[model samples]
Target chain A: MQTYSLKCYKCNVTQNDNSISRIFCEKGCNELLICEDISPMKQDPLQSMRDDEESFSLGEGSTPLIPLNKIGKRLGLEKLFAKLEFMSPTGSFKDRGSSLVINIARKERVAEFVEDSSGNAGASLSAYAGATDIKAHIFVPDSAGKGKLDQISIFGAKLHKIEGPRENSTIAAKDFSKKNNIPYLSHNLSPYFSEGMKSFAYEIYSEFGEVDHIIFPTGNGSLLLGTWRGFIDISENSNLSLPKLHAAQSSIIEPIVAEFSQKKWNFDPSSKTIASGISVSNPPRLIEIVDAIKNSNGSATSSSDNEALIWHEILAKEEGIYSEKTCAFSFATLEKLVKSGIIKKNEKIIIPITGSGLKETT
Target chain B: MQTYSLKCYKCNVTQNDNSISRIFCEKGCNELLICEDISPMKQDPLQSMRDDEESFSLGEGSTPLIPLNKIGKRLGLEKLFAKLEFMSPTGSFKDRGSSLVINIARKERVAEFVEDSSGNAGASLSAYAGATDIKAHIFVPDSAGKGKLDQISIFGAKLHKIEGPRENSTIAAKDFSKKNNIPYLSHNLSPYFSEGMKSFAYEIYSEFGEVDHIIFPTGNGSLLLGTWRGFIDISENSNLSLPKLHAAQSSIIEPIVAEFSQKKWNFDPSSKTIASGISVSNPPRLIEIVDAIKNSNGSATSSSDNEALIWHEILAKEEGIYSEKTCAFSFATLEKLVKSGIIKKNEKIIIPITGSGLKETT
Candidate 1:
């Protein structure tokens, strides 16, 4: 069996373990960490190649890079591409990671898994769990969409709805994990999980050799960071340069943006957004997210709820990609960035619509 | 260019036209029809094989044959399999037929296409239209799920929401087609449309070889009739017998069941059910649906709305397949059949979960 180690992002402490789910510092430290032993080559090369032949396996990756022809023309851009990630197996890109995560856990003889999600992550985790015949216990916010809750239930996951706010779910899940002595496969903390997102970057690179800029709807920053990592890996191992990374967020939860613009790292926990997936008040991966943005010579931008809704309608009506409000945030931010002369109209841009609108939303 | 003759399904009238859009008896006769050229099998020996490959385009066909182990045991059945058909590109099994229908239309230089759907069919048609860049106009019931409507609009298809019952959408779409002189690719009446469904039967045969019985969640009977035709073709081409066919419906819309039990060819339009997909009171292919059941020594069964809801929850919880209420109706009816000794406990049963539950419902 393959053994792994957990390395705390903050403390830089590593703990060796044979478990696939150790994803953070010890209880006393309570610091963000990542599972190691796997190289950050964007994906398990063997698994990526084998996935092509798996007939019965859930179709999880290789989402379409739809041309935003109408929307791009309207926004005065030459060309814009929206990577539709919501079309994944469980209606979210998280399935890409969850599939690999669960497979690894199963291979390591893990019988049960636990996680916390705003909605999409939980549903994806539950689905992959069911597929692999592993017992899944998911903690979700009480205010999570009913459709998402119903979907998780359908997958036979034991769901625990935590009250208060979205962050409370994570707290509850952590407490439960400690009490039950079960592994907490934190989607937010697991480096291996984010490694699954490298497929998105590889796909973009394969389709378009080099995008001038790649924008993402950010929450936990897994997508933003993972994609940057993927492009960076390609630049190191292959003959390609990394695209500039731009992170989009709702104005209601602009903590990372504020910190980026001010060059300060003060923590705040009162931020919130209607984009439930990115409503994170304080993302644990904030440092890596900032590093990705700065390293790529990109900046962070925030769009108001009204702006997000406006772009949501435009994306559906004009571009013909029926994405959720959060996805629209990226478009709105991109338009704003262009109008303010931050991003040029001539640049080739890529935006990832992270989740599907077909799933539950208010 | 290959020229083909067009024939009406109702009048058996034929016309030679180099165009693909003009197929039907006349303006007044709303029967479905197709245009094709007659040729020796040897002339296009690969025609059948090409058609087979095109029909079973790896992405669309051979969906998961998931064992309903937990649900079947509870219902006193030794084995049960759900042919998950919603995993198609457009999130519905209708893609199978829509793909073939649209491709053939495109091959014949059809510029525009029109179709009417309760929901699933419209979504499927919209996706194929987008893929082929064909002008697609779809008429859908005003009460169609928001998710489905959103999908149609997102595919750049012109959507006309008609008020009234589900059947009104078809009437309105036909009127629109006649007014514009465009081909109406009506799934309900189109032989080519149902021909796509033959892939489903082939998928089953590939998986189980031959099951003891197969049940359908029947609406317009496209799936039932299409699979039956495939089986019949297989029986004629290969040395094999067909499986017993069972048509399942909701008690409120038990027109087919009522006709089958009484051996009468009468149907009442006033009947209704919450299983909107299967709530057909006047199925155009009624005779063919009856023939399919009669020829296989099979029967029809119906379940109440409450039973369907119960089964929906049970299937989701037990089998981890989140299907719509209509899909669950088949399982509910299956349970009733098994309880009444109509379905033997030891028999291998196949039930197709027709569509996804991602769409919103009342």
Candidate 2:
């Protein structure tokens, strides 16, 4: 297997290509790093390899790009499309990352893995882990949806529920990884995992070819980052410029939006949002996220909890796509952009319905 | 356009091919009569036509034939595969029927449609109806899950909540259809709707070639009837006898099982079950269901509420398929069959999981 060297975001120092699964800048610093040189193998050869490999794919990628025909017409737009990521395996887009992460871990000879997620990520990781017959330990908030918890448990993963808040799960997962001497397959910190998400962008580009603007719900910025990379790859290799990217956040926890508008990187631990997926008070990839926004000529917008819920209802009723509040945040922001003329009515726009509404928080 | 005459099941009379969407033996008769003479176009050609026309599809058919490896090993069975139908469009097997039903309705120029369902069927119909831009009015039991109700409501369907038992919704839908002069597109009664379910049988046959036993949870018998037809077609074309079919029902609604054991043909209005989808007091295609069961050397079994719940958890924990209570009914029946020596250890078995766990009934 081909390998690459890890580079620290903080120190800008490249590390030796050790056989380690994950590496950080120093002993105690939070500056995580992963080998970024790896690219997708040639399509034809990869397809042939997969065909001959006795593939155990659980039908992970290629979600639907359902047309919002009536909604688009009603909004006075010529066309609108919502990529239904909720239709993915484990009922969330996280499955994209989980599939690749578990496969890589298997190749690395890792027997066990640990992850922390509010719900969707845990379920996704647990499912892929189950598929590969690897031991998986998931840490989740006690307040996570029972259905989501049931999903993770069904995958035979050992669940450790932290009682206090969302961040508690992360603390517990990290602690468990250390004590058990297992690799912490933290999705928030895994760049390799993020590579799997590039497929989402490829699917969109393959379908629409040239979207003028792309709006997405963001928390850890994985979708935005992966999409930006995908579009960049397409633009560089093909004959197209990347679409203007827009990240949607809940106003209650609009850290990225706050940072973008002020041109400052500050962590507000007090900020919170009912759109739990994006309720990141401190996103780990803040620098890359800011760079992505700047490079794509994108702006960050925030939606209120009420707005997200209302739009969730509208998207479901009008477009026949039932998505969670996190996914609805994108639509809420899109409406705002359209109202303010930030998004042109004639411009082709795409939004991603990130997770299924079946896992309702309420 | 091609049309077929409606033959009455009770009176053995044929009706003229009027401009009607559905037909019954008599004006007051509960059973629907479908013209078997309306030969469908060749399956391969139809599939090719769909492939040529559609721009985006998730490869909805060809679900996994997951071996109940651990459970089967425990039961001393060499093979037992569960057809994961929950991974269909709209996250349920109903998508198959809904797709066909909606296509036929669109072709027939039906402007308005109404149906009553506990959950999955309503959501499925609403989604396809929304896709085709047909007005959908769904009558659901008031006791339906909030999530399911929200799903139907999100699909922009007019939701009527029937206050009494599950069957009340069907009565309400029928009454609404009559009063409004709209077509009652019953998922249970429509032959065209059930045709989509033939894909399940085709998938199983393609995977295992020759299954000795096929088990499924009995609801409206759409899955059972469709698979039977598909297998019959395959058997006729090939040189093999049909597989033995096993219909699993909730003990609370043991109408089919009771009828099978006694070798009688009757309908009882009082048979009710917690498996809300199969709580139908009188399935319209009851005779056809009986015929399919008898012809395949099949047996009927009813699972208790406790058994269903237990198996539901087992499937989620062991198999990594978070199915609802109805799905458990199939596994519960399979266990019973194995214990009773009705199913041999060496025979290949196939079970179809009908819907997703997202539709949780409290």
Best by DockQ: 2
lDDT of 2 by residue, B1-362 (tens): 22335666666666654334675655455556653424464342124325555322323565556667667876899987777777665678887777766766776788888899888889888977775678999998897778788778777788899998777888999999999999988888876666667767766766678889998788678889888877876676688668999899887776678767874444455654557667665676867887889999998998888888888877766556777678788888998999999999999998887777767723
Against the hidden reference, what TM-scores do the models get?
Answer: 0.78, 0.86
Q: Worst 10-residue stretch by lDDT in candidate 2 chain A?
A: A41-50
What is every candidate's alpha-carbon RMSD to the true fold? 5.7, 4.1
For model 2, give the interface RMSD. 3.3
The DockQ figures for the candidates are: 0.25, 0.37
TM-score of chain B of 1: 0.86
Docking class for candidate 1: acceptable
Q: After superposition, how far is residue B294 of candidate 2 from its true place, in Å?
A: 3.2
